[model samples]
Target chain A: MELLKQSIRQRGIALSEQVLKVDAFLNHQIDPLLMQAIGREFAARFREDGITKIVTIEASGIAPAVMTGLELGVPVIFARKHQSLTLTDNLLVASVYSFTKQVESTIAISTTHLSAHDRVLIIDDFLANGKAAKGLISIIQQAGASIAGLGIVIEKSFQQGRAELEEMGFRIESLARVISLKDGQITFLD
Target chain B: MELLKQSIRQRGIALSEQVLKVDAFLNHQIDPLLMQAIGREFAARFREDGITKIVTIEASGIAPAVMTGLELGVPVIFARKHQSLTLTDNLLVASVYSFTKQVESTIAISTTHLSAHDRVLIIDDFLANGKAAKGLISIIQQAGASIAGLGIVIEKSFQQGRAELEEMGFRIESLARVISLKDGQITFLD
Candidate 1:
């Protein structure tokens, strides 16, 4: 978490009051070593939760989720943003609105991947509006799988994502919690 | 490589003569241990190529690329299929045509991540027509970066992808090469 926060402070760019760009190491470009550390941290936090699988959305979430899956010794299933031709049937689908992109896209996972007997851990790169995290939770619920917890790499604590998930009784663990990105300054939650 | 081949034999599904779905372990649902082994293999293959960075397309490719990047102790960058609000200027873009999806989409990478002095190794989940690989190659070229080689997790040898890249004089290493997927039988090149 210290390494991640340090990376954010050093390499993260505050584009505006509400936007922080970490393309250098977290989003567009990735630091594998940091991702591995993140994985270890998440695994350590939720190791005793009886997690059978790790779930995340496609694109940015895949790296952290895959690393965590490795550390947890579990398989990772990424919900697809773009529906593939082969993955049409038996899907656990949810519509997620991205506040950054300002568009609503459907995220789906094959029902064959998740089962009622499994305990799932949800992971992602950023949590702002809680829309994506909520969508993953919806899919997990649809499969009748139990929720292990939510693991986030970077959380915009100024936003309503964390409060909303916590209100829903989901245990959330974020490695880097950004309290504010105001006036071109990045502040952590400490 | 034998482990990968064995996985394909056991879990891979031949939907048609042209489409082989390994979603059980490669695309939709991922096996992390297998991915770690894949990373070690890719790193071992390209360890001496002087790889300064690992480049891959988003989603599925991120897992393997991140693993390989971890092994090589280098940073990994994934091209974005969907444009982000913050990633608007100073971009290296290429249009990729997905044969399976029958659609063409633009993939872009920020100029800040790639540079002329860097030696990049391209990693992807699958190589069929090689359009995605070619697009990454174009972006790397635009950045004035020299390519070390191409590392693919699975390659359809019967398709024109491998031949096309080889004709273009790019070094390619595929862990699992499928020579045929005819009559529901999965045959390897070996």
Candidate 2:
């Protein structure tokens, strides 16, 4: 976690008071060493939750989920996002609103990948407004799977994401939580 | 490679004669153990290429790139794809035509992540017409970086992808090469 925080400080850029661009090391381009460490941290936090699978959304979330699945020795399933919501009998689907892109996309997973007998851990790169996490949770529930826990890499604590998940009675763990980005400075939640 | 071939034989689904879906273990629902094995196999094959970074496009490419980066002790940078092309001074961008989706998406990477000093090895899940690989190659050339090589999990030999890359004079290593998908049966090239 310390390594991640340090990497964020050194390489991450705060474009505005609210937008932090970690595209240098976190999302767009990734540091695999830091990612592996982040995965280990998540595994240590949620290893006892009986996680049979690690679930995440496509694109940004796949890297960390792959590493975590490797560390936890579980399979990783990523829900694919589509432009429009498509209902299918063989898939579990959910809609997510992207505040950045200002568009709503539907994400779905195959029913065969998740089941009532499995325990699932949801992981992602960023959690702002908690929309993506909520969508993933819905797909997991649709599969009749048990929620092990939610793991996040960088969280915008200033946003209501954490509060929303906590209000829903879900355990959330994040490697780096940004409390504020006031005056283009990142303040971590101690 | 044998393990991968066996997985394809057992879990891969042939939807029609043109599409083979390995979502059960490759793209959508990923087997972490198999991914790690894939990374190791890629690392072993390209170990002497002096690969400074592992590069790929977003979504499906991130998993294998992550594993390969971990195995090679390098960083992985995935080019983010956007619906409409965004041309920026700070980014190296290229347009990739997806034959499956019948859409052209623009992929870009930050110029800071890639440079003339870097030797980048491109990795991906599937190689069909090689449009994605060519796009990544364009980005890398734009960054003034050298191509280490290209590593693919599965290559559709029936398509013109390999020919395209070969025409461009790039070395490509595919773990499993499918000669044909005739009659819902996958025929691998020896």
Candidate 3:
């Protein structure tokens, strides 16, 4: 977690008062060694929980999900923004809006993948509005699976998504939680 | 490679005479252990190339790319498909027509990541028309980076993509090269 915080301080760009760009090492470009370490940390934290699957929504979350799956020795299932021509699943779909992209996309999982047998852990790169996490949780619920927890790489604590989820009894785990980014300064939740 | 072949034979569905659906393991719901094996095989094939960075396009390509990067001990940079309001990088964007999705999308990469000092290996899930690979190659070329090779998880041998690239003197390393899928039977090039 210290490495993540240090990386945030060293390489994370505070673009606006609200947006933090970690393109150098996290979002666009990935540091595999660091990802392995982070995945190991997650495994250490949630070793007691029987995590049958590590689920995430695609584009950026695949790397960390893969890393965690590798360490945890579980499968990683990434929900798709668009149903591919090949995708033939007909079970559940959730409409989630990305504040950054400002577009509502549907994230769907195959019924063949997740089922009542899974104790899922949802992971992602950024947790801003928590729409993506909510979508994943909904999919797991549709499959009659239990959510072990929600693991996030970077979380914006100023957002209401986490608090709302906590109110619903959803466990949230974040490596680095950003408290405030006012005046080009970052404050951690500690 | 044997493990991958066995997985495909067991879980891969034949959609048509030319389509192979491997979503259960390779694409949609991914098996991390199988991905590690595929990555190790790719590493074994390109281990002598001194790959500086692993390049891949987003949505589905991120899985194999991360695994390949894990094997090579290099950073994986996935091209962004959907442009966001928060993305401020003056990027190198390539317009690619996806025959599968039946839509044209722009894949972009920040110029800072790929440079003349880097040797890039483009990795992707499938190779049908090779437009995605070419888009990635163009991005690398724009950054003045050298192309080590292209790694593909599955390749439809009937497609003109590989021949087109081979005509340009570029080599593609595909794990499973489908020779033909005649009457619901799958055949391999090897």
Candidate 4:
């Protein structure tokens, strides 16, 4: 967690005091070493949660979910943003509102991947409005799967996301939680 | 390679005459143990490439790139689709035509991460027509970076992908070179 916070402090750029551009190591590009360490951190925290699968969205969330899946020795199932012709099956689908893209996009996972017997750990790169996490939870709910916990890499604590998940009584753990971003400075939560 | 072939033989599903879906372990749903094996396999194949980086497109490709990067002890930088507001200065942008979706999408990468100093090894989940690979190569080209080689999990040998890449003189190594999928029978080429 310290390593991730340091990495964010070092390379992450604050855009307009609201968004942090961590494209250098977290979003666009990735530091595998750091990701592995973050995965280990999540593994240590959630190893006893009976997590059978690690779930995440497409594009940005795949890296963190894969790394965490590697640490926990579980399978990683990612929801697809773009429905391709190859994906033809009964799927658990949900619509997510992205704060960044500012659009409501549908994400879905195969019903065969999730079941009532599975304990899913939802992981992602960022959580701002908690829309993506909510969508993932909806899909898991549709499959009748239990959520072991929520694991996030970087969270904006000042946003309404954490409160929303906590209100739902979900155990959400983030490696780096930005309490506030003021004047290009990042503050961490306790 | 033998292990990969064995896994493919065991778990891979034949959708149609020409479509073989390894989504259970390769893309949609990832098996961590198998991914570890895949990581090692890629490391073995690209051992002589002296790869400084592992690069790939988002979504399905992120896992393999992460695994390969972890195996190689290098960083992985995944190219993102669509225009991101966070990415103010992206250097390399390439258009990739997806045959399955019949849409040409532009994938872009930041110039700061890739440079002439980095030798990138491109990794992907599938290579059908090599359009994605070519797009990735275009990004690398824009940054003036050297492409060490390409490592793909699966390649359709009957398709023109390999030929296109070979015509461009890009050294491509596919773990499973699928020759044909006739009547749900998957065949591999040497």
**Candidate 1 — which residues are off by over 4 angstroms?**
none
Please tell me how candidate 4 rates in CAPRI terms. Answer: medium
Q: Please say which candidate is ahead in lDDT: 1 or 2.
A: 1
lDDT of 3 by residue, B44-104 (tens): 8898998999999887777788778888999999899898764577799899988767799
**Every model's TM-score:** 0.99, 0.95, 0.97, 0.97
Which candidate's lDDT is highest? 1
| Candidates arranged by lDDT, highest first | 1, 4, 2, 3
Clashes by residue pair, model 3: none
How much lDDT does each candidate structure score? 0.93, 0.86, 0.86, 0.87
Q: After superposition, how far is residue B86 of candidate 3 from its true place, in Å?
A: 3.7
Please write out the lDDT profile of model 4 over residues B16-93, one tens digit for every residue: 876778878876888877777888899889878889988998877888788888888988888878677787884588
| lDDT tens readout by residue for model 4, A1-190 | 8899999989998886778899888888888788888888989999989899999888888777878898899999989888776677798899987777767789989898899999999999998889999999999999999998899999999899989999998999998899888998888896
| Quality of candidate 1 docking, DockQ | 0.84
Candidate 2, B-chain TM:
0.95
* Better by lDDT, candidate 4 or 1: 1
Which segments of candidate 2 are over 4 A away from where they belong?
Answer: A83-89, B83-89
lDDT of 1 by residue, B1-190 (tens): 9999999999999888998888899899999999999999999999998999999998889999999999999999999989897786599999999876778999999999899999999999999999999999999999999999999999999999999999999999999999999999999999
